[model samples]
Target: MSISITMIIFSVLFLVFIIRLIKTATFTLEYSLMWLAIGTIMLVFSIFPQIPEYFANLFGFETMSNFLLVMAVLFSLLQLIIFTKYTTKQTDDIKSLIQEVSILKEKVKKEE
Candidate 1:
């Protein structure tokens, strides 16, 4: 199969947008790297359409598109798990800070 011009153009546009976002501080490097890597990979694949098919065959996927979808879903789930952990830690820290502040306020009131 041959790569389409539209796909290549879209991938390049996406890569450019991602870099602009990073430069503008809209997304930190760590947060933006995943999308940057994805855009880069898509740009590469758009140039070499056969690479994905080879990977699909090596992985026993019936189609390269299916392999791509599965990988996207897996990555999304992994990100969700990481975000959940980060949120939980933040919540706990907030609770601890609030409790400490209340205790300090109580001590100040007693002294006054």
Candidate 2:
């Protein structure tokens, strides 16, 4: 019924979900690893239950919720950065493939 117990339960469930996704190839190892790490960190925090509060005090946050909100935002920004990198790489790969196919088509035309 306590917050720490609830957190531990949720973390365990999330970890299981991530593992299932990895096993089913729904998520790449890279993505799964991030989720796994997050889950593990949540589990650790649930066990300690006050580390975040300590850090929040150290950082002069008005409240624990404010600290958590800032942490969530930072985590989201990092995830966005990672997805952007992946999208850029995919775009470049598609461009390269298109160019290669076009060159092959040109060679075929010349041969014919």
Candidate 3:
């Protein structure tokens, strides 16, 4: 149950990141790459954690290696949240600027 919920959350975020990448192809290609890498890495390890243990020990928790796994999931979640907020704010600012331009154009036409 919990695993399904987690998968759903990750899937939604992965979709959003892909959509954003397509929307802003050039400027964000690099940024999108990093997010994709993080998401892919997390998902892979979440499914098969021994892969990370083989590479390097991210943590030395007493019993549950799940400690490191949880931390990685959390870090990925934080990155996604930050990216989403940033993209939302960027869109809002662009809309505001376009509105301001239209208002200025209207004022210039009235002056003429």
Candidate 4:
């Protein structure tokens, strides 16, 4: 019923979901590791509710929620950048593969 208890439950469920994804090969280890780390951090914070409050005060935030929100936003931005880099690399690799296949097809045609 309390926020901390809810967070703890959510964190556990998230960890389980991530593990299942990894087991089923739906998510690669590299991607799952970030999620796993996030879940672990969430669990830790939920277990010790004062940790975030202490950090918020240390960082001069007006409230712990604001501090958490800022952190979540930063994490989301970092994830976006990483995924963008991966997408660009995959596109380039696909283009290279297509070019290679086209060249091979032309060679086969000439041989035939």
Best by TM-score: 4
Worst 10 residues of 4 by lDDT: 27-36
Which residues of candidate 1, in runs, are more than 4 Å off? 1-3
lDDT for 32 (candidate 2): 85
RMSD of each: 2.2, 1.1, 7.0, 1.0
lDDT of 4 by residue, 1-112 (tens): 9988999999999999989998999988888888899899999999998999999999999999999999999999998999999999999999999999999999999999
Candidate 3 structure quality by residue, lDDT tens digits, 54-106: 55544655434566667678888988898899999999999999999999999
Instruction: Give per-model TM-scores.
Output: 0.85, 0.92, 0.43, 0.95
Q: What lDDT does the true structure give each of the candidates?
A: 0.92, 0.91, 0.73, 0.94
Tens digits of per-residue lDDT for model 2 on 1-107?
99889999999999999899988999878888889999998888888868888989999998888998899999999999989999999999999999999999999
Ranking by TM-score: 4, 2, 1, 3
What would the per-residue lDDT of candidate 1 be over residues 1-112, giving only the tens digit for each residue?
A: 3346888999999999999999899997787998899999999988888998899899999998999899889989999998999899999999999999999999999999
Badly placed stretches (over 4 Å) of model 4 are none
lDDT score at residue 109, model 4, on the 0-100 scale? 100
Candidate no. 3 TM-score = 0.43
Candidate 2 ranges beyond 4 A from true positions = none
Q: Provide the clashing-pair count of each candidate structure.
A: 0, 0, 0, 0
lDDT of 4: 0.94
- Pairs in clash, predicted candidate 3: none
